[model samples]
Target: MGSEFAEKVILITGGGHGIGAAAARCFAEAGARVALADVDRQAGDRLSEELIAHHRQALFVEADVSEGRDCKLAVERVLDTFGCIDILFNNAGITRRANVVETTEKEWDAVIDTNLKSVFLMCKYVVPVMASNGGGVIINTASGWGLVGGKEAVSYCASKGGVVLLTKAMALDHGKDNIRVNCICPGDTRTRMLVEEARQLDLSTDDLIEEGIYRPLGRVGEPGEVAASVMYLASSLASFVTGTALVVDGGGLAGSA
Candidate 1:
């Protein structure tokens, strides 16, 4: 175990699976006490056990991040258990694969609340704790589609876009308090969410996976890769970095022309 983050406490939303789970493991491996908050109690508890089995400090908090009360409660539990939050990974999000017209009001609200508002809610409570503690790091998970646009993913794109901008705004507001806020815009990553996105679009999983490899990197990214990026942004190595959207998208957004 590395001690880079030995005394740090990292709270991750959506910590049950995919990139969120990968990030929890990564931070724990680096010696950080990790708080896993997710709507799925089973997955969250399972991951916490796995980490504890490895002798890592870990806690699982069931939370629906979209709700302010849940976000507040999750932060409170982490603070009570870990002392103070040194880092926060706002990785909770959902996707609604539909064009604007085909998208219903509820679907749009759900995506926005989960993907964007959760970041705000988490920050709303965590920022003060971080500020009083002297300083901290926050890394949000945006998407490549957030920077650009995607067909049949209006709600997803919009929500992620909001996240990207919200990250920047928070960074600007919190830099004075020594809180660094940054977001990663990943390309097609191999996650349950990605698989479900294909299903929503009525596409074969094999076909979708195959198409993902057409990017410059010639392969879809794994959750671990994205987790690594989050780790970087959360570490002191990025002390001077803030208000930036770090793209980890295998160059998919690179113009073909």
Candidate 2:
């Protein structure tokens, strides 16, 4: 409805639900054609259809972004459909609530590949396309735990921390090409991921949600709030913002160790 991103092509990984889905809606509302990539074909198809019903351009591509080949194919589909990618949101990630000793090697690999490797793979393909088209913005979803650490979430923390540093490193590598790379470190949000986190710990979702409100805001964040940050970074409003880990944690990290 808005012209903020009119005629732009946006690619979002893990875009079937949660923050990724919210970002897809936000960008489409701003007039960007969105390519929603997720392993859940059903969810991705449903969201894409909903966006299309609203007269927005959107495509769903089922992909296991953790794998290099799937990442390439997903980007290729987007390019073929939308011509060029103007924005890339490496927001696909998975979390495992386990300490190092409690975590199995399989779980560790899943967490790392989903949360960290996917970023590398998406950027690996999307970066050159953006560079060829002059420039673009990339926003990777990190976490507050990435800055500090979290108990029982060793693998998740490690992956997000890597995303933060990778964002910085990529910014340094691509600034000359006018490509801006950044990451967002969010606090607890009201998403299926948060509910799953509660389930992983054998805690009731409501109780865990309440505990998550320990920050100054005294409430969990909505996916839309996180999506707004992505919109800002993608827009010209944040033209000079790159290589920064913008924290949207509602003061949760103010005194965190």
Candidate 3:
């Protein structure tokens, strides 16, 4: 049952660290060949080396998913190296903690492009390849704010909401082609991004983490926990799943707004 991904080729954007990195490791451990794409070339290369050291087929592609050309080229590089792409984890993202009025155009564009449009660009290039190859799975990283609004993160909320709907729409469009589209709405996972959010709010990281512990499960989630959800979606375990927002939030969203 767990060997469902044996020899499958998987691509993960933003795979240099945090949840993306964890997801790459999970797939590779499950016997999948992995391509780790990120803007951080050093981290990606280092991770690829580590995976290969353990006898896993892994490649690192330096990519800024916000750019269409980079997205296309990254996919091409994966195909050139691995021959086929069987799963895609669109996990690249950024965040700006500001209300609509306080948000700059640059901040808005950067967040939207990275968190949302990158998914579109990646699918534009990879979906056809998946269809041509018979079928594939796509898992996107949304946010808890995507399903419910936050106080000062307007752009982030908007981008993630778009991701949720985009997942559903893509599922509707590609189900006939045997493509499964799903999004993961994660709560406050322990990552650099979570720490950055604290910095943006001028709060101490410890305080921020303590606040996150107020969730139903009494703690912020671990990146590896979120990666486990992604692994499930990418494997045959979720063969009947599509167009769903699997919330790996430690029950953070189970309560009301």
Candidate 4:
């Protein structure tokens, strides 16, 4: 496809690394002004610099997405710099590998806040801007676990499940305003988060990755692969898509109920 995002403004959270960073590059390369928000100042700044070197408009905002104030400030910075927000990618998230019994209150809170509440906070700020602008696209990062149960990952599953439903609710409430809300449910993407899950579960990262490849597609997904789905959902190509969980899971959930 040609540059579908030319002259557009895109805000991506968790843009410091992994899928978020990849999505930032994808949108920027497609000609969007990308504002990257993340808790990691160094990574975000470095990526922003790199994007600018590529002749794309990019800004890095250091903000903990778990806090509403930080979310508001990030959106404000984007608006102040870019003049308007055309796309909002609520991609900031963290994962913890613990069943309900094993998960502590603090850990649960941290995961839920980062992975779920962050979406709510970002939307609270960006939705109004999109409504004022007439229309926009919002893409949230959900997970395959959000749709199906996974062993020893209760909190992660719960948080992503919330994202899925939240996307639907936002789509329903905002469609009249020309804002489309949707989510990508990716499975076993090769990222730091996936490796950390292996460490948390006391399994070798190699073994964990091998097991992930047991899916019908015979391999774990790349961050760039998931980014492609985000691009599709964010662009005009998916104009009719909304309130849907687009699974980019390499058939991991295709055989399931």
lDDT (Cα, tens digit) per residue for candidate 1, span 1-257: 45779969999999999999999998998888999999999999999999999999999999999999999999999989988999999998889899989999999999999999999999999999999999999999999988998999998998899999999999989999999999999998888987888889888876667787689999889999999999889877898999999999888888793
Query: Candidate 3 residues 1-257, lDDT tens each?
Result: 75888899999999999999999899999999999989999999999999999999999999999999999999999999999999999999988999999999999999999999999999999999999999999999999898999989999999999999999999999999999999999999888987898889998986667887578888988899999999988877899999999988888889855
What's the lDDT for residue 10 in model 1? Answer: 94
Could you give candidate 4's per-residue lDDT for residues 142-202 as a string of tens digits? 9998899898899999999999999999999999999999999999988888888889988
- Give the C-alpha miss distance for residue 20 in model 3, angstroms: 0.2
lDDT of 1 at 107: 94
* Candidate 3 Cα RMSD (Å): 1.2
**Model 4 stretches astray by more than 4 angstroms:** none
Q: What are the clashing pairs of model 2?
A: none
Checking candidate 3 for backbone clashes, the offending pairs are none
Which runs of model 2 end up more than 4 angstroms from their true locations?
none
What tens digits encode model 2's per-residue C-alpha lDDT throughout 147-179?
998999999999999999999999999999999
Compute each candidate's TM-score over C-alphas.
0.98, 0.98, 0.98, 0.97
Instruction: Count backbone clashes in candidate 4.
Output: 0
In model 4, where is the ten-residue run with the lowest total lDDT? 205-214
Candidate 3, residue 4: how far the Cα is off, in Å? 1.4
